[model samples]
Target: MSSELAEIEGQISDIFRALSNGFQKMDKIKDLNRRSRQLEDLTDKMRESKRLIKEFDREIKESQYKFDSETTKLLNEKKQSMIKELNSYVALKKRYASNIDNKRVDLFEGPGDGYAEENVMLASTMTNEQLMGHGNHLMDETDQAIDRATKVVHETIDVGTETAASLKAQTDQMSRIVNELDSIHFSIKKASQLVKEIGRQVATDRCIMALLVLIVIGVIAVIIVKIVNPNNKDIRDIPGLAPPAQSRRLLWHQD
Candidate 1:
């Protein structure tokens, strides 16, 4: 009995150890589940961030288009104004040359004192000064128009550059988030594998322990039956080895 009790206690200790290992595995499984949930949360957050980044990208594109359109319109307006000024300057020059030719003809062909020639010279001088002024004004306006157009072009280019940089930054950040999500997902998977492996090991140990205990109990029962009646042939002859007196009583009762 002491040996049996000792054996039982040892088996119980082994079973407890196996149960502890199983509990450890359960703990690992729980930890894995928690990490999986965290990964899912992070994935959801990344998806939301990606959605916002897409919206930002769309806004940046729209802003770039508007800037391009406005800048082009401003440049075209400046070009048109310069073209009109150039055309006006050409016409004024032609008119001034025609007036000079007409005055020279009058001075040579009409009968007048030499004072007519002096008046003609004065008229030519005034026309020349006016033409020079108009030329200067046209040049000044052309320069100003070109400067304005250049400024608009540069501003448009700057806007485009900023938009592109913002888009690139958004893309890079999204990529980083995706990478991080993948890493977390992988860690969750690894943890799950470890939990399963540990659980399998614990279950195998428990099965072995149970089988050993069952074998030990069977051996003890066999030893006890053999010790109770060493020379009991009639008892051994019964289907399950009933003792001699017990079988005799059973037969008498049936009769």
Candidate 2:
């Protein structure tokens, strides 16, 4: 009983530890896309750990019946503690996500702000050819940034689609398992009723057989008593047991 909860608890702790390390490492990753991907991985790990915690809670509930009150209370307390830890991580993830989004917004808008000021200064001091060349370079950089953002968006979409499909498959499988369990429960109930009916029929049959045997024994006892005491009239006068009476004298009797 303890073994099951222990395994899940250990897994949750490991995943949480990994998430912490991943977040720390992500801080050092300067590329926006790489950091985003790293964050996604840690998010996935956090999700797994959340699932493990839920499973652990369910396991505790299932085993609670076997535990004393104090033990059950202690288990509940532990579950709450794990939940708080998970929530703290959840908060940390949200904070990091917000920060990333802010950075992304700046990445897109910051250059425009700088260019606005630069254009003013350059327009006053540069030659027409130099101005054209600088404009072209700025355009090229903007196009590259757009392309990178587009690629990141596509990757995120693909990941989301795959995750959705996997979750749906798991949901369907769980539904089938629950349905199978319900059918098995019904079958067992029917079998129990059938067994009870068979037992009743057997009991009734035994009672009838016992009655038949007693009746046969009673008849044999009466016959043995009559033979042992011939003067007993119980059967002596019975027409079938008596010696044939002398044939009634007939009008034409033969000697």
lDDT values for all models: 0.61, 0.86
* Residue pairs with backbone overlap in model 1: none
Error of 1 at 193 (Å): 1.3
Cα error, residue 83 of model 2, in Å, equals: 0.9
Model 2, runs deviating above 4 Å: 114-255
lDDT of 1 by residue, 131-164 (tens): 6886798699889989999999999999999999
Clashes of 1: 0
- Tens-digit lDDT track of model 2 for 1-255: 488988998898899789878878977999888988988898898889888988988998889888899988888898898889888888888988898998998988865685787779868898989989988998999899899999999999999999999999999999999999999999999999999999999999999999999999999999998788778665435667754445434312643
Cα error of candidate 1 at position 102, Å = 40
Best TM-score goes to which candidate?
2
